[model samples]
Structure formats: C-alpha cells, structure tokens
Target: MRYFALATDYDGTLAADGRVTKDTLTALKQLRASGRKLILVTGRELDDLLQVFEQIDLFDYVVAENGALLYCPASRQEKLLGEPAPTEFIKALRDRQVNPLSVGRVIVATWHPQETAVLETIRDLGLELQVIFNKGAVMVLPSGINKAAGLAAALDEMKLSPHNVVGVGDAENDHAFLSVCECSVAVANALPMLKERVDFVTDSSRGDGVIELIDKLIASDLSELDEQLQRHNILLGTKKDNSEVNIQPSGSSILLAGTSGGGKSTLATAVLERIAEQKYQFCIIDPEGDYENFEGAVVLGDAERSPRLTEVLDLLEKPYENVVVNLLGIAVEDRPAFFAELLPALLELRSRTGRPHWIVVDEAHHLMPASWNPASLTLPQQLEGMMLITVHPDRVAAAGLSLINTIVTVGNSPQENIKAFCEALGDCPPQIAPQTLETGEALAWFRGKQTEPFCFRIAPGHRERRRHARKYAEGELGEDKSFYFQGSQGKLNLRAQNLILFIQIAEGVDDETWLYHLQRGDYSRWFRQAIKDESLAEEAEEIEQNNRTSAHESRDAIKGAIAQHYTLPA
Candidate 1:
C-alpha cells in the first residue's frame, strides 16, 4: 500500500491518437478495484477530453489544460486551477496571425511554429507567462502552473501525499508532474531525455506501456523495484565496511533500545531530522514531553493539558505537518489506554494516505507493556513501518516486540539489551561481543538476516540540542562541571550551579570579577564542555573576543544567548 494512487498522462501515454484502448480501460478498471485512486494529467482542454473520451468516469480526478484546470468525473465539476488566458495576450497573438490558435479556460495552445510568434507577443506585451512544449504542441499558461501544480492540488484535496503516488507519462511536458511523484515511469515511446530521468521505462510503447505499469503496480505495489529507488531511503550510517546503511522507507520496524541518559534521544533526534528532510511526516508519541520545542515538529500537548485525538487528526490532514503527541498531562496509569485508542486511529489514517509515514512511540514499554493484553489493544500483525524507542524492549507487549526485526542498541551494554529482547521473544540471541558504545555509536542487528551485530557511527542531528537542558537549567551539576565565579586574585568563591544561578551571579558580580571570567573564556568553556551546548558556546566565544564592551554589556549578551536557547525562571 505504499502507492495509494496512480497519476498518468493522457494523449501520448494513456491514449494513442487521442483515444484509449479497451484493454487499457480494463486495466484502469482493475486498478481502481484495488482501492487505488486514478488521476489523469493531460495537455488537452476539458471539453476536448470529455468529447473524445467517454470513459472519463473511470478517473477520480482529471488535470486538464496542461495543469491549468481540474475536472472531477464523478461530480462533473470543473475547477480552474489557473487564471483564464489573458485577453490582452490572446489579442496580441491574433494580431501576429499565429494561426490555428486554441484557447481553454487558462491555457492558449498552438503548434510548434507558432511558438516563435507567441514568444514575441508575450515579450512585447510584457506578460508573465511560460511556454510549455508537448511534442509539437506549444501551450502558454501562468508561470508556475503546470501538471505538477494541478496534480498537487488534486492530492491536497484528496488528503494524499505525493510520496504515495506513482506517476507515468511521455514527452517533455510530462517531466514536471512525474518528478513530483514517489515513483516516475516513462513509457517506451516517451522522449529519450524523459526516459533517461525516470525510475523505469516500460518495454511496451503507448497504452500498452501504461498497462504494463499498472500490472506491475497491482502485482506487487512494485516491491521488486524497491532496491532501485534508493533516493528515498533514510540514511542511518555506514557499516564497518564503510558502506552506507539506511532504513527503507517502508517495511522497517525499528526498536531503538538503551538505558536512561545513554544518548538515545540524540540518535532519535538525528533520525527524526532525516525523516522530516525527506518530506515524510512523522508523529512522535512522547509520554514524558521531552520533545517540546523540537525543530520541524508541532507539539500538541503540554504538562497542563492532554492533547485531544481529534486535534491530532485534524492537524495531520494537512500532510506536510509533523506532530508530537505529548502524554505528560495524562496520568501514567491511563497512558496505555490512551495509546490503545490512538494507535488504531493513526493506522487507519495511514491506510488511506500512506502517512504520517512514521509513527514514533517514545517510552514504548509504558504504552504497550508486557502485562497488557495486546488482543484488547487490537494490535495488527503488520504495519508498513514505525519506530519504537524504549529502555526496556522486553517490558513491551509481545506483539509489539515481535514486530521489531531490526534492533538498534545504544547504551553501556549493547549485548545485554539484545539478549533481553531475544529472550523475551523466545529466540536465541545473536552472538554480539561485549562492547561499550561511545557517543553517536550503536550496535545494529537485523534478526535472521545478519550473522552478528555490527557497530556503526550514528549520524548527527541537524539541530544541536542542549542535552539534558532542563537538568542543566534547574538541577545541580557536579562540582567540577558547575561554573564558579572565582574571579581575578581568587577573591570570590561564588558558585553558579545552574544556568539560572550563572546568569544571576553574572549580573551581580563585581565588574572586575565579571571581566576576569570573560577575558579568561571560562563562560564559553563551561558552556561547551559542561552544558554540551555548542551553539551557546559559539555565541559566548564571539562576545568574549570583543572585550571593548563594558562588563554589563557582555553579561547581558551572554545572558541573552542562554535565554534564547533555554527556558529559564521568571
């Protein structure tokens, strides 16, 4: 179900000589029966398409006029995707005697030779328009309006993502829309340039090529071709052989297990950032509210209130949004029951839209504990893909744990975590050497696939998180890590245990004492090595280098940097 829709070009791709064959029609019908929607993208006008093709009802949506208009067959409603052909531009074309001109709701078209005249007329008129070449046909439309725009509009209306679509076409004009689809196919008769760029080229030309694509799509959802489409893979890291490793867009149920304070969140953040980069939506089920203010995501609930399921569903309907479902407001005893209700709803949404592509369950054991009956939870035998992050995989329900064929261990003892997981599932654990993983390192074992677990360096997150930022902001740091205001001549023994205390002390310390610490680079050093916040340290270093500023100004600048990064007390 990775591809929930097929968008195909008309004329050269779906029909030959402006007509669809009986066999092609049959294929379309068969494909529609598979619960997949069909979109017809064409350069032809809506009126011409309706007159020539009596089987228009077979399509869910028709993008006509080279992306300037949308037609729904069931409702027989026509929506203008772009403005109508400019009257001044049309008059200028006629004045130039560009013969054989045909005008639609938004597109004005003519044969190849007329394009020279059309271009001149647009130039003279100072009109903002673009010329698209479809075989010999030249069409003019508003800039930025094309088959891709029309198709995107249709998908938006349908609540579908372009990532769940397979598009097929021929000729140069087909390039725009096809490029936006998850998988692009060029028919054998397609232009050579187009064939070179597409994911696959059908052996059969014309309508037969479309039928070939359809058969393959229905047969396996094109799973056999997955390996060839590596552009969509989520890069995790490289293995010992220095070969790149990735999580397939679908079919990978990963369990990221580690102990508390073991750099699990760091790895998880990196993976989440990559997922968002690929335009795949993800929903994080965060029980502890750790993801507040995470980049590229919308936090749904906070400590004071539980997020409503309806709100989550409504926000996800937009397709581009990532959500964090924080459960801290919900009582711990009620969290599992809340998740039991939420997972099914999310699965149902994914069934239709093929997104939010990844569902990240944080503290997975708490939500699907071993003590709970998975039958009552209505856990499915398979999900396209999801990520489960927890400290104890064995504590999670058996059904949930069984789905984790790919295990990634990130902690002091990788072998112990893997053994606990395998023993819980009643399977022999793979022989992994006892090794303590370093920061940004993890042991990965694909059960029944790899002979042994392999260690790989984890990719860094795009945004630098102030790790344990809450702790560093409010809780006590070790005496060594804590900042001390022992300024010049060691006159003051003031200790600033946290960021809150550090800022307050910086504001009140003697001017000479503050200047001493600023000149010594102690503030930047502690921020980098102790708080482990690189961005903050960079800002502090910049302020420290410019010593002309008064101590009050430097203190304010340093305080501002910290406040911008971390939430502090009022």
Candidate 2:
C-alpha cells in the first residue's frame, strides 16, 4: 500500500510559536501537488487557526477544537463532530477564582498550587476529557477523542486507511495520531514522550524535518516496488549452446488428449485448484462448464446458455480471486471467431494491467486450430504460466506451441500428439512412451530443450471446491466439422479467445491470405448463436458496422466517431 494522506500537528510539530517556516510550506506544497491530502489536527479555534495560517486553501482539511470539529479549507465548510463543553464545567473553575482560557473545543490553564481542588471540580462535572501537558500549556479534550480521531475521520473521507497514512507531531497531544499512521516522524526538538512512540526521529527540527521525510519516502517507494515480481513456476535461462532459450513448466500449452472417461478434465481441475490456493488470479476457459463452482471463480457461458461477450468483459474488469469463463455450450463452429474478438481485448487489458498469473484455455483446439496466425495477436513475452487443455492436440495450431513454457501430458496413446508437438516445437526429439498414468498422473516437460519430462500425480479437489466447478456442454455439431470451419476461416483471431468463433470467416485457404482477411475484419459470413438475445445481437451488429466503417476512415477520425458514439448529454 502507498501513503495517500498526511496528518500533522500545526504548532510544535510543523512550526515554532504557531509560525510555519518557508521551507516547511514549500515541502507541504510539493506533497499536495502529488495529490496527497494534507490535514492539520490541532486544538486551535477557527479564528485563531486562520490567523496563524491566513493563506486560504493551504491545507485540504483541518481538525479544529481537537477532535470535536471538522473543517474543509477548500469549501470553507465547518462541521461539529461532538457536543459542546458543559457550561457548568467552565463556570465552576471560575467560581474558585481560577481564570480558565477557553480555546476552541479545549480549555487550558497553568498548573496552580491548588491544582488538587481544581481537579476535583472537573471530576464533579461528569464530563469525559483528558489533560495533556506540553511545557506550560495544559489541554483538555473529550474522552476517547484526540488528534488521532480527527485524522481518522479525514482519511476515511478520502478512502485511505491508516496503513497508507503518515503523521508528524512533536507534542504529547499529537501522540494519538502518530501511533496510528503507517509512518510517524518526530522532530529533533519534539517532546521525549512523542519521540519514543514514532517510527523515525528526524534529525532536523521545524520545517527542515518535513522536507527530509518526503524525500526518503519517494525514493524508497519506487525502488521497493521494482523488486516485487509476479510469481510463476516456468524458468528462463541460457541453453548449452550459449543461446537464450526458455524452460517452460511444460511447454507453450498442454493438450490433454485422450478418450472419454480418461481423467483429462479431472487432472486439469486438480492443477487449477492448486494454483488458486497460491492466491493468483486465473481464468479457466471451460468449454464443458465443469469448473464454475470453484472458489473465487467468475463463471461465464454455461450449460444453460452461453454468456454474452460484454458481460464477460464486465466481470473481467472487476478484481476476482479466480475467474472461470465457461464457453462449453456455444456452437463448435463459433468458438474460433469467439476467441478471435475476445483474445485481442483481453490482450489489450493485460497490457494495461499486467497479465493474469495463468490463462487456462480448455479445449484449446476449438478456439485455436493448427493453422491460426499467432503473430497477428500480441503474445505475453513471458508465457511462463499459461495452460491450454485439449483432447485434439493435432488440431491446436503449431505456431501457438512455440511460446509454450511447459507441457503436461495426462493420458495414454499420445503418439500422434507427440509427433505434432515435435514438428511444432522446431528442433525437438521424440520421446519413449510412458506405459501408464493414473487419474491425476501426468508427464510434465518444463522447458523447450529438456531431455526428459517430470511425472507427477495431482491431488484431488476438496468437497468445498465443488461449488465453483466449470459448466460443460457439447458444441453445435461434432468436433471434426467445427474444427474444419474454424481452420477455414482464413486465420482465427488470437486476440480474444471468446470472440474467435464470431469473427467473419474469410475466403481462401492460404495461411497468409487467411490471416489478412481475419485482420481486415471480413466478418460477413460469420454469426454467433450464443449472443442471440435482442440487446446483445443489436450490440454485435453495431460492432460489425463500426468494424466495416473503420476500413475507409482515418485513425483520428475513427477515434472522434467513437467519442461521439459514447458522448453523453450535459
């Protein structure tokens, strides 16, 4: 978390004799420019407060009268947080011939020889207040109320927590605020009690101390952030040939090819369960809709009806513990084009917000066939944590395998898939078959140049994990017919995995020509049945119209047109 607010005491903490130094004001201005909220929590009354710092809008908010009042400098608005002091409390002190100075929400006086009698009078009033001594000044405030409460209320308005707040003070009254902030700094000239409770004690007193703290904070934040990297198992290092190569956990993608009841889905579910335990967000493209019930999952598309693209996009934008996109019920012919439109938007979002720890695309061949153009779409340079599961490894595009960091094989009779893998992986040797694999057992290859694959059996999911299981359903037609249509669509869209099945199928068989047609938005021949609802169909038609018009318009003009489309009335 980053610091977003600073609450400092005004008198002894930031200035001397209620006078702010020129350097202190300059430092405060710099922090304000960076968008940090500055709050002054003090016991001074409104009039005396403005008199001390007459410059308007110098602070974002002020906590006047200790914790009893809140003031917004920008709007010049004042709100009282608690009840006023009892008239009897002040009148009794005066009855004893002891003059009490009423300052804002606080009352102060000198430590007199008859202090015990004065203390008894205060007790009799039945008011909750504390006496804070700072040199010769004795301050009294409401019970359970102090500078800390003032700062807390200010921070709450800005949606900032104590973990992201910093406070600086030098007197005993300021102790409450200092203890709650993430970082509290005490000036050299501060009281001994305040110094002992803070994190860092600044060497410079007054305004100079304020400048030193900000400089250190900015320096530490930038450096510390760079050291935290996204966690992934795939390793990348130099090969024996002194060439730079990747050692993926398995390979670019893992195709779980096997007959029905072969435990492929079970094995994949186990891996997903383990990854979720690590707390990394992952999205499972469940064609069968079996993984929706898992914890932290954001299910999309289903056995009941496939989800619209826009709905999935909305869920993706919100932070999720785990996201499972179930595309199981969509027609087989639509999966490729569905992915085509969906992948690009996902990639664009990933570029903006850093990629998910893993993008588990189940039934890979349905969305990405063997001849699809991988170059046209932006690929995550570091594909250390991507999992693609499929029963038809031969149907998955070979070009997509080049970026695989790992390959996990979960069933038997993988001779054809192995041949396809060797051919797609560039220079790779064939491997002897593994005789047998249990329900969760798999042959894991972690890198491109490795000689042997690691074999391990995955664990089972807990009973609690059943709620988030994926929604599974068969496609429009059989697998073979759908694969042919997807392969013939020129080049499938690799940008959006969800919209690949909806892309306009372009004519021509050549890979280059197919890729060109797909990129050019030649979607006249394709339509997705999954988005047949009235509102969704209209939106889809609008998108097609926009894509068609984009071909003849200038880029800037197109942007202006889009802006016009989304513009709202004043």
Count of residue pairs whose backbone atoms collide, per candidate: 0, 68
Best lDDT among the predictions, by candidate number? 1
Residue-level lDDT of model 2, residues 186-236, one tens digit each, is 888898887877777888886677777766555563223222212223222
Top candidate by TM-score: 1
**TM, every model:** 0.81, 0.45
Off by over 4 Å in 2: 103-118, 218-570
Give per-residue CA lDDT, model 1, range 1-570, as digits (tens): 899999999988999999999999999999999999999999999999989999999999999998999899999898998888779898888888998999999999999799999999888989899999988999999999999999998998788999999999998898999999989999999999999999999999989999999999999999987878877898778877888778787778899999988878888888898989988999999999989878889999888999999999989988899999999999999999999999999988988788889999999999989898853357787765789999998898888888887888897898899999999889988777788988778888887684578889887676634446778898899999999898789978999889999988888889999999899999999999999889999999999999688888998899999999998879
Off by over 4 Å in 1: 240-242, 375-377, 465-570
Candidate 1: count of backbone clashes, pairs at least 3 residues apart or interchain = 0
lDDT scores of the candidates, listed in order? 0.90, 0.59
